[model samples]
Target: MGNLIFLSGQAAIDQIGGVVGPGDIDAQIDQAMANIERALNAVGSGVDRIFKITVYLTDMNNFESVIKMRERYFDKPWPADTTVGVSALALPELMVELDVIATRP
Candidate 1:
C-alpha cells in the first residue's frame, strides 16, 4: 500500500525557532518550502510525490511573488493546492506557511 504523509505547516522559522525573512515574502516562501522539503525527505517522500498542498500567506498582495518563488521548489507537474491569506500566523513575523501532503513509495 502506498503511504500517505502529512507534513505540518512550515513557516519561515528555522529549526532553532528563529524567524526567517523578516520583511521579504520571497525569502519567507523559500524558507518555508525548503523546510517542507526537509520534512518530506525525513519521511521518505519528496516534492514530486506531493499531491495536495495548502499555502497560507499573511498578505494576498504577495500572491505573484509567492507563485514565482514557488517555481524553485515545485516543477511543471505541480501539486494541487489551495492558498489563503490570513491576517497573522503563530508568530508576528511569520509571513508564509506551507502544508504538504504526499505519498511515500
Candidate 2:
C-alpha cells in the first residue's frame, strides 16, 4: 500500500486572506483550492497526486461556479470527486469546504 496524506484546506485559505469575503461561493471555492494545494505540497504531493476529493457546499446550485474553478486545479482525467450540499460547514461564513485524499510515492 502507498502512503496516504491528509490535509486541511481551511488552513491555506487563512493564509491568502483575499478580498473575497467568507460568504461568497466563488471566493470560498477558490480559497479552498488554494488551501488544498498548499496542504498537498506540504505533504510532498501535488494536486495531480490526489485520487479523490470530497466537497461540501452550502448550496448545490453553486456547482457551476465550483466546476469553473476546478478546471484551474485539475486537468484531463480529473480525480474522482464527490460533492454534497450541506446545511453548514465548520465556519458559518464558509460557502464551501474541501477534503482530499492523496497518494505519495
Candidate 3:
C-alpha cells in the first residue's frame, strides 16, 4: 500500500501556529489551505494526490467560500469532500478547519 497522509483539520494558523484571520472565514480558509499544502509537500505529496477532505466550519454559511478556495488548489477530477458545520472548534478565532487525506508519491 502506498503512504496515506492524513492531516488533522487545519485552521487559519500562521507560521508560529497561531490562529489567524479571526472572524474572516476567507482568510482562515486561505491559511488552512496553505497549511494543508505544506503538510502534503512535506510528505512528498501534493494537492493533486489528495483523495479526500473533510471541512469543519463554525457556520454553514461559509460553504461557498470553501468551494471557491478549493478551486485554487484542486482542478478537474476533484477529490471527495465533506463539509460539516460545528458550534465551536479548538479556538474561537478559527472559522474553518480542513481534514486532508492524500496518497504519497
Top candidate when judged by TM-score against the true structure: 3
What lDDT tens digits, residue by residue, belong to model 1 across residues 1-105?
Answer: 359988877889888989898999988887887888888899888888888888898899989976785587778777888899999999999888888889998
Q: Which sequence of candidate numbers ranks them by lDDT, best first?
A: 3, 1, 2
Q: Is candidate 1 or candidate 3 better by lDDT?
A: 3
Query: Using Cα atoms with residue i matched to residue i, what is each candidate's TM-score against the true structure?
Result: 0.91, 0.82, 0.93
lDDT of candidate 3 over 1-105, digit per residue (tens): 568989996889899978889888888888898888898888899878998989998899889997887798798788899999999999878888899889996
- Stretches of candidate 2 above 4 Å error? 8-12, 16-20
True-structure Cα RMSD, model 1: 1.5
Worst 10 residues of 1 by lDDT: 65-74
lDDT of each: 0.84, 0.74, 0.87
Question: Tens digits of per-residue lDDT for model 2 on 1-105?
Answer: 558887644521566464345657776777677777777788788888888888887888989976786688888777788888899776667777788888887
RMSD of candidate 3 to the truth, in angstroms, is 1.2
Q: What is the lDDT of residue 7 in candidate 2?
A: 60
